[model samples]
Target: MRKLTAGLFHSIDGVVEAPNLFQFDSFDDDLGALLTGVLGRVDTVLMGRVGYEQWAGYWPNAQVDDDFASFINGVPKHVASDTLTAPLAWQNAQLIEGELLAFVKKLKQAEGGEISAMGGISLVRQLLFAGLLDELTLMTHPVIAGTGRHLFEPGDPTTRLTLVDSQQTAKGNVVSTYARRD
Candidate 1:
């Protein structure tokens, strides 16, 4: 079965939204290597409407020399959106058919490389709680983002996860990977 995974640029205070605002200072070569490794393992990308739209607007037209531009532009993207229609403008992107969770469940059964849930906070949360996401990696930057949306909010159901791997980058970013405890 294909593994479904998600990685987030997180802050010490748990903020996962808009890492671009706070992560650049600590984004070092080690962190870049980590992300590149993850990208290498992933052949399919999954994202919500917001991330899809945001990336579609940029990556496709971004300079070819950009590290992520070619990879993101070429990879197959499946977008989960209630409002978006088929034949998305982005190359290799398409709206998901049927129920989101059901579609993911079936996709997991299909033979393929790793399926990555990219930069979609809501989608990652849903997948983690629904037990669909096989792994979650948090590249926790050493900073306190005082105001931003967090990946886990108050009143969310308790979910137990086992740490599978962790490392501290030279620039003080802590990369941690976890798997749900079944």
Candidate 2:
């Protein structure tokens, strides 16, 4: 079975929204290498409607030479959405209908390298709540954004995770990888 790994960019205060506003100072070759390594292992990308719409509007036209742009534009994207229609504007993109959890569970059981969740707070929360996520990787920058969408909210289900690995970049971003305690 394949594992569903989530990759998220977060602020020191756990804000996961608009990372572009805070993550620039810490970006370096080390971060690039980390992103390259993570993206290289995943064959599939999963996200929610909001993230899908936002990404589809931009990534397709991004610089072709960049590793992230190239990978995201070419990789098969699966968006978990109920309102999105077919013939998605983005290449190799498809809408996931029906039950979200069931679809993800089936995908995990199928043959694949790994299913990576790019950045959808709602989707990640659901997957983590359902015990469907296998790993969670956080690239936490050293900034405290007072308010934004956080990865975890009050009344969210509590799932225990084991810290598999962690490292700090030269710019002080902590790259932590956690595995579900199952």
The best candidate in terms of TM-score: 1
Q: Judge candidate 2 against the unseen true structure and give its global Cα lDDT, from 0 to 1.
A: 0.88
> What is the TM-score of each predicted model, taking all chains together?
0.98, 0.96
lDDT, each prediction: 0.94, 0.88
User: What is candidate 2's lDDT per residue for 106-174, written digit by digit as tens?
Assistant: 998999898988758899888887888888889999899787889999987677899999989889999
Clashing pairs in 2: none
Q: Which segments of model 2 are wrong by more than 4 Å?
A: none
lDDT of 1 at 107: 88
Best candidate (score: lDDT): 1
Give the deviation of candidate 2 from the true structure as CA RMSD.
1.1
Off by over 4 Å in 1: none
Question: Per-residue lDDT of 17-126 in model 1, one digit per residue for the tens?
Answer: 99988886899999999998988999999999999988888899999998799899999999999999998999999899999999999989999999999958999999
